[model samples]
Every structure is written in structure tokens, then in C-alpha cells.
Target: MNCEKIKGKVSIRTVLESFNLFPVKENGKTGFYFALDREEKVPSLSVDYINNKAFDFGTGKNYDIISIVQQINKTSVSDALKYLEKFNFQPQEIDQKEEVRSNAKYEIIQVKEVKHPALVQYLKYRNVCDQIHFVKEIHYQINGKKFFGIGFLNDSGGYEIRNKYTKICLGKKDVTLLKSGMDCQREVKIFEGFFDFLTYRNIQRGANEVSDYLVLNSTAMLFKAEELMKKYNIISLFLDNDSNGRLITDKLFNQYNAVRDCASIYTGFNDLNEWFCSSGRYCDY
Candidate 1:
């Protein structure tokens, strides 16, 4: 079983039974192990001695390997193999490093042409016009494709778009489903991007109540929040506490009513996730 499945079924007894092994307990589980040792006096096998398929137990903890074999009743070799496969396990460690892409130049590597039917459905759901420009980039690597770039809505504002007199690419943002309208919810929370919104969702998992979510695709779209604010009773702005973020928040608060800035909660760090990780707080938020 995978770790999640194992955890789901695990109790102390169930765990021991699963391995056909029992702990040599003393003093209510606080005791040293009494088992046969190797030449170096190391326990020959133990629960800790886990491998790709099942764990081992130290000697003197007499266990019938056949008992386990019998417990998994399979009529054929293929069936037995299938049953055993679920118990297979592997131990691995991986370290990840962040590679910064500073001034990285990329060609219009490739375009993912969206099928018209799906594109129409998506645009309809977002209340976006059909003529709003759309394109997706497919990034490639030596092995194969690396990442699929986000499809964006063109806003006709960026330097490249201005030169071409066409719409600028405004990267796609997810629309969160609120249980109720923002005005009736009592608390409205805003995020600069969908990633930030999702990170906030992770941090606030199992929270007492679900708050309203508003994701502004870019700082330039901060003005768009005015219409949403008119409909919402309480607006909580969680913009990045950076200069641009602050400028956007100030502008929104000054021009719109019933808007409050909560970005100050993470003033030390430039972004919410960074601040949350660095704060050393007990809660994820």
C-alpha cells in the first residue's frame, strides 16, 4: 500500500499484524530490544530495515514468513503478485533547488492551439468575450517538453502589444467559487494572483469559515476591484507588501470605499507565502 493507504488502516496492532511481527515490549513500550545480532552487534533486521517490498524483523522475534504468505490468499502467481505489489515500498530522498530565470530569453517556442469548443466553454464560464486574444506557450527541454506556459487574456496595454497595436497577454487566473456572494459573506479577501490564492487556501485549510476570494490578475487590474467592492460589504486586500503592491493597495483604498489593507501582516517579507514560511508561527497562516 502507499503511505496514505497504510496510514488510513494503521493502528498499533494492525501495523504489527501487517508485518507479521510484534514489538518486544517492556515497561509499557519503553524497552531495549532482545534479538540476535550481526558480527558487529547490530540488529540483523528490524522494522526500520525497510526495502522496496516489505520490512524485516530482528531475529529471536520468531515470525513465520509463511504466515504472512498465507494471510494474503491468492489463487495464482499473478494474483499473489498483484496482492504483494500493494505492500511494496521504497525509501527515497530528494532535494530541490530554486533556479532563477533572470532575463531569460525564450522564443515563441510553441503554441497550444485550443480547440474551439473547449475555448468557447471556458470563455463563457469566465464571462469573457470570444474575441479576447488567447494563446498558450509550450516550453521545450532537451528530453522533451518542460512546462506548458499559461494561456493569457490580451489587455492591449503591454510594450510588445502597444508596438503591435494588439492586446497584451494577461496571464490566466483561476476563479474561486465562493459559497455565497462577497457582500453577504462579511469578509472579502483579495489576492494578487491565483498561486497566492491557492497558497492561502493551503495555509487556511480547515479554517473555521471560508472567506471570499478575489484574484486580481495584475496590479494594473486593481481598478477592476472597484465594481466587486461595490457589491461586497467588507474587502480585505492581501497584496504583496512590496512597493508596487503597496502603491496598488493605496490607490484602491483611496478610490474605493469599504476596502482595508491586510498586507501589513507580512510587511517584513515581500510576499505572503514567504512571510508565512519565515514567521515561525504555529499556524500555517
Candidate 2:
């Protein structure tokens, strides 16, 4: 493969090839460049030649084209290639339709079809004992699954959990069960994940009244502000007061009636799960 003499014998040909980037050579030697598909464009990293070495301006480090391409491939291949096109290189127009990709299930993993009575007991222990019990149902899907580690019954009367990279829809029955167990109607409680919801249930058992529960599996979902606002009368957001969490809460509070910040009680903790485990409050449970 022919390469461009950008600096320090850096082989542009090798870098593009490793990233599956094919180069279009002109007049056989002086000019070598590649055409990129639409999905291959990424502007995060920039390449510059200085002192005869290829330097990556984004990371502020000098790299051989091969090493740079390898690192880009590992991180986000789509974004990496766009950075390369910053030079006078031609890019190929790829149809967005072919960009089907899968990502990892970061939160939960499915081990087997094994059913454990312990999960049921754990649910009951959390004071989520509604007339309708939720049996543990586990299955696998090919698109990969998000461990979600969290889920909630939306006002639309549906259950939602995060799968590998997307949200999986739950049946209305599950949502009914969650709503039945929740004590919040006028009052509200916000939680980051399902386990925190369980923890809160366990703590609030002997308390006077139960508040409505809202589980925001990922704060990013809160961008759908209308989803939560239309359903509840008194809305309470139980979000960590950190940068991202606070950002979501502030945005929602603006359009909603009332928003409560539980982390104010213990600013040190990030979320309810962290608080349950660390805050000396729920030590008994």
C-alpha cells in the first residue's frame, strides 16, 4: 500500500487500512488519501506532522500512524475516521441504513434460566408486597441487553427497563404491580435504580405514609420531561446533586410543580443505593 509522507516516515496507508479505510492514490506516490463512509467520520482526533513525526492534537501525543489508528479502532471507530478527513482527503458517502451496531450490557448479565426464591424474598423484604407478586422472569435477546440495573412503571401504564443499549418495554401487568405497591400519590420519591427503590421501601415500612415512586434508570431519559410531568400531581425527584444528576433535576423542576432533592440530606452520597449502603440511616435494614 502507498502512504503519505506527512512526517517521520508515518505510513498513512497502514493507518487507514487497519481502520478498514482504503486510500485513493494519485500519480503513484506524492498524494495518497482515503475516502470515508458517512459512519466513518469523527472529528474528535486530529493529526498533524511536526518535526517529521505524526502528532495527534486531540491527545497531545506523537504517534506512529499504526498505533494511532489502532487506538482509534478500539475506542470508537466511527468517530476516529472523521478526524482523519480533516486533511484534504475525500470521504465516501455511506448510507446511514448500514450502521447497525451493538454495544455491551453494562449493568446486569443473564446467567441462566435459574429461578431463585431468594429474589422473591428480597422483593417482599423490601415492602413491595402488593396483591400481585412479580415473579422473576429472565430471558435473552440477540441485540444484547442492558443490565438496566433499574426500571420503573411509567405513567403510560407500562414498565420500562434499560437493556444493553436501549430501553426494553415491559407489560402493563408489571406496571400495575409496581403502582399498586407504591404509596406515593400526593408525595413522590425519586430513585436512580430499582435496588434503591427496594431500599427505600424497606426503610419507609414503619413510616406513616408511602410516597409515589419514580425510577430514572438513566438520568438521560429525564430529557423526556413531559413523560413524568403529565402523570403525577406532586412530583419529587430523588436525584444525586452531582453535575449530571443536578442538571437533569434542574431542567425537570422548571416545568413541573415541585421537585425534591433527597441528596441534600446527605450530599456526600451519589444516589439512594450509595446512601443506603453508607449513610448511617438505614443500618438496621
lDDT of 1 at 237: 82
Model 2, 1-285: lDDT tens digits are 123432223235333432332222223232222112112222322333222224433445554553454455554444544433322111132221221121212233343321345433443443342311222333434234323212345445434442223234343212112453564466656665565665666566677665556665434233333454556676666676555466556655665776666667657776665666664442331
Across 140-229, the per-residue lDDT of candidate 1 in tens digits comes to 221232433334322332111111111122222122333443335666788775445545655665677645677654443443345556
Relative to the true structure, candidate 2 reaches a TM of 0.43
Candidate 2 positional error at 145, Å: 12
TM-score, cand. 1: 0.38
lDDT values of the candidates? 0.41, 0.42
What stretches of model 2 exceed 4 Å from their correct place?
1-137, 141-177, 180-185, 208-210, 225-227, 279-285
Worst 10 residues of 1 by lDDT: 91-100
How many clashes (backbone N, Cα, C below 3 Å) per candidate? 2, 14
